[model samples]
Target: MRSRRGVIEVNTAQIREVADGVPDVCIYELLYNENIEVIEDQCLSKRKCDSAILASDGTVGIFVKPDLPEEYRQFLLWHEYGHFKLHYDENMHFNFYLSRFSWKTEREANTFAALNLLKGEDIYDQNVIALLISKGVPERIAVKTYESLI
Candidate 1:
């Protein structure tokens, strides 16, 4: 599916809106309806990336480093999905050795992932990291994303 493009000024609330569009969890199941193909690549992390997306020919593909634990793999998939939904510039590179992704963009993706993963949870009343862990978010990312959110 084509992204809502030209939105370079996205915020956490905006990401929340995007997550609201998704009716439920199990992103792996949702991607098919979104016309996104998922691929498990053993070499992804060898390239210095946990996950990445490739958009082409009216289909978006999310490639993940399968070596990661299942929870982290799911988180990475959501993160890349955030990129696809938000800043989906076709020219978005693989983020080369000389050109890392912008910090803000990465953070936005993580925020989207966290928001979506914990959509039905009461983040205000619980330990955020523990909550995220229960929902399959990695402890490190859960901690950092929780910290960033607060």
Candidate 2:
């Protein structure tokens, strides 16, 4: 289930362009009435989980700790966007509010996040940790995500 440690190989640049092209509001803001709306309705919060929500209308809500580095926040938001695009089935209205590990859905979202953030890089590579660090990823998460890869 693991690939050799190498640079992340997804086309992050294109993903980033797609992410950047999104409207300049916190996608969450567009989905919920308040930041706490996600926490209350979805039971997912930036304070606890680096997670996001996908509304049925194709809107995505991303929760990020405000204190985290901006890059990390961007990655989380894009990850949520990935769910909106990849996991959301317009015909399935009840599937939008899912947990981080709700079957294969979250996996795809995570893949979207990892690939978008570290495209052209390998999570299995030796310098992977350093590269994530250079990109302003938190040291603990960088290490944890690295470990989770294997």
- CA lDDT scores, all candidates in order: 0.77, 0.52
Q: Per-residue alpha-carbon lDDT of model 2 for 1-150, expressed as tens digits?
A: 211432112333444455444445543554454332333333443245666564545444455544556776666665666766554555554443343335445444554555456765555646876776676556765666555454
Q: At residue 38, what lDDT does model 1 achieve? A: 88
Against the true structure, candidate 2 reaches a TM-score of: 0.48
TM-score of each: 0.80, 0.48
Q: Which stretches of candidate 1 lie over 4 Å from their true place?
A: 1-7, 90-101
Clashing pairs in 2: 5-124, 5-125, 6-122, 6-124, 6-125, 7-121, 7-122, 8-121, 8-122
Error of 2 at 7 (Å): 29
lDDT of 2 at 107: 45
Residue 140 lDDT, candidate 1, scale 0-100: 77
Candidate 1, position 1, lDDT = 28
lDDT for each residue of candidate 1 in 30-128, tens digit (9 for 90 to 100): 887788988998877578777888888667899987767887778888888998887776665444223344676778888889888887776676788
